[model samples]
Target: MNMPVLTSLRRRFAALAVLIASLPGAADAQADPAATFTALRAVDQRMATIAYRLTTANAPLCRGLVPVPGWAVHSLGQYDPAMRDQARTSFGFEAPIAVEAVVAGAPAARAGVVANDSILAVNGQPLRGAPGAKADSNARDAAQAVIARQPAAAALRVELVRGGARRTVAIAAPAGCPGSFEVLLGPGMDASADGSIVQIAVRFFERYTDDQVAVVVAHELAHNILRHRARLDAAKVSRGLLAEVGRNGRLFRQTETEADLLGMHLLRNAGYDPQLAVAFWRDHGGDVDGGLFRSRTHPSSKARAQAIADEIARIPAGSPRPYLPPLLATRDTPLQ
Candidate 1:
């Protein structure tokens, strides 16, 4: 994207204001999410074509052409750390299985799904390997196609093998929260005030453990350094103007990718092992249902993870760690 000369003028004034951020809201009451999403998506997709035609056909006439998310703005609304805790699973296991604990405050617990129940199926789909990596690509494709057809609250038929006997139960999935840790009877990392204070709730780190927790923190912190909220605001204004003028321009589709790259750089510089970002996603992001890039808020899980890997490779993998503390006074003396 071309940096506007005006942006340079604004940079000095925007610096003090640049450090804050906020939690973005959802679609307005008048807007239907499904339809609004569709229309907005169409404009984004055709941005380049519209801009090119306008500039080529008549450039001088369309000068003030940049109007961002006037009034309001939007981007890929990532439901990461928030939703990890609220996801649900149904069906009983057909055999004895090692229960991987349970998600707190979910339908499973409400429906009396005890740990080690050994789920067998969800409305007939077996839990032994349902809707996950265990299921092959074709199985995954077929499962997604079939499951999407079911209502959000459709009854889940659960079959389980417990104590060497078959049992049946029914459960339903529920709406999720913004961060995964909320469902775990605890708090999690949060970024707000437009990126000023990155609060982390790491009290019960066992469940998320090791690099997973660190990666989440690193990602949130990355948002601050990248000034994503402000950048997105600027991009939206410029793009929205292009859309309103009925022109197609090269859309800012790469913003999310750019954030991933720059965010990774910041995280690695802050001393986090970049490779652990990959493992963190693998642990929780295989079946993400959130947006990626302009289509959504954050980059796709694959892209974010890859960005981290790519960034780490640019530096010495095992370089000395960087510290965040303010530099100490040189006058302070050590025992000699």
Candidate 2:
């Protein structure tokens, strides 16, 4: 995507965060910094867990892959300046970045990398945090890029500070589907995947069970796995007012249908119940019929549930890992 378009999407993500802070009880949470941080971590941890399962389980089906350390990092600089001090105290952010959450039984957990360990460097290269936080990601992105460059099977040496003691650990970063999963702190019940990132609103965590939320995550991940954004860009599809009309609308709907179908397989591969896709759509689809989830560029909720149910019925019993659906063949084909 072009810089301008990417910037616009990022702005939307930031807006979601602001919207969350304005909701009921949000003010009270913000008043208590510790409570706010705790709640944020809970949401982030859930997203990390779900993303790890889906990405690692279906890595073979992805066109682009990256080493997943089974842990997520956060920078104190990413928080608002008003909350920076509290964040530093809460998370022990001794460096620019720190391990925010680690998936149990994953590479990072196996390596003894725990949450609150401040990451000083990766592979001997220092990571400097940005000053005057307005949610900058330079340090976080740089660290991830360095790790992604490592050999698929090699261990990643990380320098971190734990309990004020600096130590290094070698994490056997395993390959997984590309893109980072993030929780957008907001009340909006929305989710989206830009070619390189999958973001779900915090409301999903607040309202739905992890299994139901996983249904949405799998759908977004499928979009990235199929390169839907890039394909739409390649086809020169209009993303503005024209996006919901004519050929642009048809193409967008096609991608959504593809994601919905493949998403069922992804859910199954990740050991999640594919039936939740139908349940989730039936329960909350009407609530999201406006805004980004408008029917113009997406099929109706009833149609989506039926299609998912149909696809689930088609999958053979006891399908193997990384189930290859027929739709995978068209992922690389130029969009119409």
All candidates: CA RMSD (Å): 23.2, 3.3
User: TM-scores across all candidates?
Assistant: 0.31, 0.90
- Model 1 ranges off by over 4 Å: 1-193, 199-207, 237-255, 286-295, 316-336
Report the C-alpha lDDT of model 1 over 1-336, residue by residue, as the tens digit: 222111111111122112111101212412433332232222222221221221222211111222111011110111122221211121122232222234344455566665546544546764232332121223322332333344443555566566678777666643210111111112223222133223333221324544455454444434444454455455554443452232122223344444345434444544455566666654454333133322233345676677656655666545443422121121122211
| Residue-wise C-alpha lDDT for candidate 2, range 1-336, written one tens digit per residue | 111223222213244346347333345564565766666666677888998899888888886577888988877767666667777887888887888888889989998999899998878888776645366666677777777776666788989898889999999888788888777554556678888878776777767789988988998888888889888989999887787899999999899889989998899888888898998787777765563457588888888889999998888887687789888999889988
Q: What residue runs in model 2 are displaced by over 4 Å at the alpha carbon?
A: 1-31, 291-293
Cα displacement (Å) at residue 106, model 1: 37
Q: Per-model C-alpha lDDT, please?
A: 0.34, 0.77
Lowest-sum lDDT 10-residue window in model 2: 1-10
